[model samples]
Target chain A: MSEKLYSISVEVNGVARSAHVPARLSLVDWLRDDLRLTGTHVGCEHGICGACSIMLDGEPVRSCLMYAVQADGHRVTTVEGLANPDGSMSVLQDSFCKCHAMQCGYCTPGMLIAAKGLLEANRHPSDTEIRAAIGGNLCRCTGYQQIVDAIHDAARRMASGAK
Target chain B: MKSAPFEYLRADSIASACEALRREGDSAKIIAGGQSLVPIMAMRLVRPSLLVDINEIAALKFIAVERDAVRIGACTRQALVERDDALASRVPLLRQALAWVGHVQTRNRGTLGGSIVHADPCAELPLAAQVLGAKMVLRSSSGARTLAAEEFFTGPMVTATDSSECLEEVHWPVWSEPRTGCAFTEIANRHGDFAMVSAACQLALDGEGRCVRAAFGLGGVGQTPLAFPRLAARLLGTKLDEAVVKSVAQDAAAQTEPGSDLFATADYRRHLAGVLAARVIRAAQEKAGGGK
Candidate 1:
């Protein structure tokens, strides 16, 4: 059976984009397939795994559970948006590398987006807060200590005004 | 997996949302946050013919402190509730329970009304609402009405709200009495996962440090959030000593009718409910005593 389509205009990664998609099309699929922004990974189609996490209106949300139509007229920041204007690695990205936060890298994008969302709200999050922020993002590789360390390190670096 | 094909309609106002719901009837589903609904849709568990998107209904997203109660608009995000200092102070138990709702990401998109309407027996918000004796405001194209939490939740994933009726807001009473405290405790498989067993308690102590009133709610151990008036009555006029609390907890646990699930056996859940009831009651007592 043919599916109905809806037009959606969203501001993704600071850019205005428009698309005509199926009503059931998830934002993650639209981003990965239509928009060609493949950095956002989809692990569990359900909301359990945070691999599909993205910033919806500056707050981390599971994109896999959100329809593209629902994202219409909203702002979404995927992992691709976490880079500097000059295309260099963002502070959190660099910290992830420095701390060896990812081994298999399957869950990196969601982890970075989650960490970015956390550092944006709390520039100086405690260890407990850091743990809670990335608690949704499941990283089978790093055992989460490094991910927590990366977020903590990024928080400190950002607080110190380090670029 | 992708959800089945469906038509989508965005409602700019509550009236329009209600109209759409009424027009579409049972085949239409309201999408607020879409945290729970979309996941079920992806699994092809439910295929509604139409989706009335209420995320743009700006009027339905608010947290207001009314004269006698705190009013949370149905669409208010869970994360907003978790971070609101005023809400935290006014309803500390709700905030404590929200932390256990889902992870930060899920909370960012999950709505208070959606969770309450979803009515998961194991969910934290519904249990908190039950223990707090919150009121649910339901709106339809024809009129509006309110129901208590106990009346609103009929069973697991079931509520008294009709498909045409929108859950507009929830009013949680503000405990103005002195020496009042509330606490929530749950045992989940993981930090952010749904609870295997949960307990929430509210206590009000008299000037003499005697229990004046008490309410306890148990989740993941029954079809709905379970509360025992008889058990609560047993604590009245007492100092809530370990012996009294233990007996109350035991009675509460015995009253639960948990069904065996993949997560836990019915017997294990009953046992955990007792343990959690005792723990949260003691914590509420300490908090009432001005302990952090």
Candidate 2:
């Protein structure tokens, strides 16, 4: 049986996008499949893993926990949005690459988004704060040490006016 | 896994949400924040024919610090609850308990009303509500009614709310005492995971370092969050020394009907309940006395 489809208009990655999605279509699914923003990975389809994390109005939230219809009028920032206008890597993204934060690269997108969300809110987060900020995003590899180092490094880079 | 297909309606107001609930009848479920409900839905545990979306109800997303209570609208996000300095200053335990909730991503979407209404046996919000004697305002198509946290939370994930009633807001009473302190602690396998057992308490001490008012409770050890009013009353007029606190905590823990799970045995949970309850009561006492 087919359910009714609802049309949603969302500003994703600074671009206006529209789609007809079923009520059960998660925001992550639409971003990954419909819009081809495959940077956001789906780890745990449930809310536990932050693999499908996206910035909903500048705050990182689990896209898997939200339906596309729920994003009808909101602005979303996927990992793809964490880039300079010239397609260069953002400060946090570059820090992740420099620090070898992800071993397998599966959780990179979500981790970048989470770290971006944190650095946006707190320009200079302490070690404990960085650990807690990325606590939700599970990275089996890198022992989370590199992720912490990457966030701290990004904070330092930004502090030195190296954005 | 994906959720079963269901009709969705974004409610703009409480009356309309109730109107939709009454129209949809028993097959309708309210979706707030969609943190827990979405996961439960994705697992197919529940497949409501009509899912009423109350996240857009602006009236149901507010925090009003009243004379002696903080009236929090049901849709106020947990992230907001965690960040609100004013709410934290008044009802400090609310903020303390929020740190033990789900991760940052979930908290960004989870709502205070949704958490309490979801009413998990081990959830932090309901335990805080119970410990604070929070009041729930339920609204229906016909009218509105209020219920205390004791009456509101009937069982694990079960509430006194009927099919057509939606929780409008929660009234968390703010302790007016000057020398007040609260502590919320839980034992989870991982940081941000569900608790094996949790304990929280709010204490007020007079000038003589004597307990004037006390309320404490244990979660994840019973069908519902268990609050010990009578045992807490036993704390009044005492200095809440280790002996008295431990004795009261042991009694409170012994009364819990904890269930054994993979993470912890029932016996272990009961023991932790006793230990944590005593620990928090003492910790709150110390804080009230400006110990830390």
Candidate 3:
């Protein structure tokens, strides 16, 4: 027997969006395939990989591990929403570019979102805190040292009153 | 990794959820954080025809400190529980256990009630709940009843909760006895992997610093989290000296029936449990005395 699909209305990336998704439709699928928010990549599909990481109500979560219907009425932020309203890159985004934090860039979106969450939580996270914050996220291409350096640079720029 | 399709039901009330579960019968499953269930569903391990999303129930997200107990609603997120000021002040062991549960990302979405209902034998919350003698509140269309930690878990990934019932809340007793302390220790391959062997120990000291009440719980050592009642009795009324603590830890480890897994053999786990028991007990004792 198949389950019924439900129409759920959720605010995605500051825009109120609605979708009719099957109960089995993962939140990552809804964002990447249905809403065309490909910035949120799906990796492993299981909770092991943080490639589908997104901010759910200002908290980082693996979108693949949640149903689209479950995110109804919740605020979701994807990598595309990292830019300002004027489409300018955030400090973290610019830092990634400046620090050459992208090798293959497969895990870049998830890394950016994860770092975005960390910066919002603690604008001045220590090296250890930075490591702990992004521990769930994995980058097979660029060694994590670059990601850590990018986040630290971003934090420094943000603290120095730089946009 | 598409999950098997199921009829999605957004329940606003506990009564409605129970009724939906009853109507759907064994073909229904309730989802809180969907951290564990969604993955299992994607794996097709469970293909319930009805998917009950209980996130809309606002009543199931509170943590209240009661007179004799702390009442935690089922939908309480692990991060919220870990960061809760009251829980940290009263039950620091809970925070310690929370750090061992999973990484921050997983903890952000994993719910306490969902973790307990999933009942993974190696799960940190259930093991901690068992050691703390927590009580689960199960509600259904018929009525509600409370079950202790040991009774709540029947076997691996199984609980006493019936098909028609949903876990409402868990109540953990608050210890007001002075000079008492608790500690939890777990060793895993990574930050979030299943623990090889974990121990939770509570020590209560008397006026002369003698052990008054001692409780020990061992995890990942059997089909269910176990308590070392006999070894606890041996520690009670003792001076908590190094020799006595070592003896009690060895006895506690001997009582375990650890299962052999790829990460550790049963004998190795038993040995680790003994070492951990001794370490955690000593730490709890030192903390009780406000020392190193």
TM-score of each: 0.98, 0.99, 0.96
The sequence of per-residue lDDT tens digits that candidate 3 reaches over residues A48-108 is 8789999999999999998888898899999999997899998899999999898988888
lDDT digits (tens) for residues B144-179 of candidate 1: 999998899899999999999999999999888789
lDDT of 3 by residue, B116-204 (tens): 89988778888888887889999999999999998998888999999999999999877777898888888888877768888888787
- Cα deviation at B3, candidate 1, in Å, is 0.5
How would you class the docking of model 1? high
Using Cα atoms, each model's DockQ against the true complex is: 0.88, 0.86, 0.74
**Candidate 1 segments whose C-alpha is farther than 4 A from its true place:** B290-292
Which of candidates 1 and 2 reaches a greater lDDT? 2
Q: Is the docking of candidate 2 incorrect, acceptable, medium or high quality?
A: high
State which candidate has the highest DockQ.
1
Lowest summed-lDDT stretch of 10 residues in model 3 chain B? B283-292
Worst 10 residues of 3 chain A by lDDT: A1-10
Which candidate has the top score in lDDT? 2
Q: What is the lDDT for B31 in model 1?
A: 94
Model 2 per-residue lDDT tens digits across residues B1-292: 9999999899888999999999989999999999889999999999999889998889999999998999999999999999999998999999999999988888999999999999998999999999999999999999999999999889989999999999999999989889999999999988898788999999999988889999999999998999999999999998887789889999999999999977788999999999999999988887787433
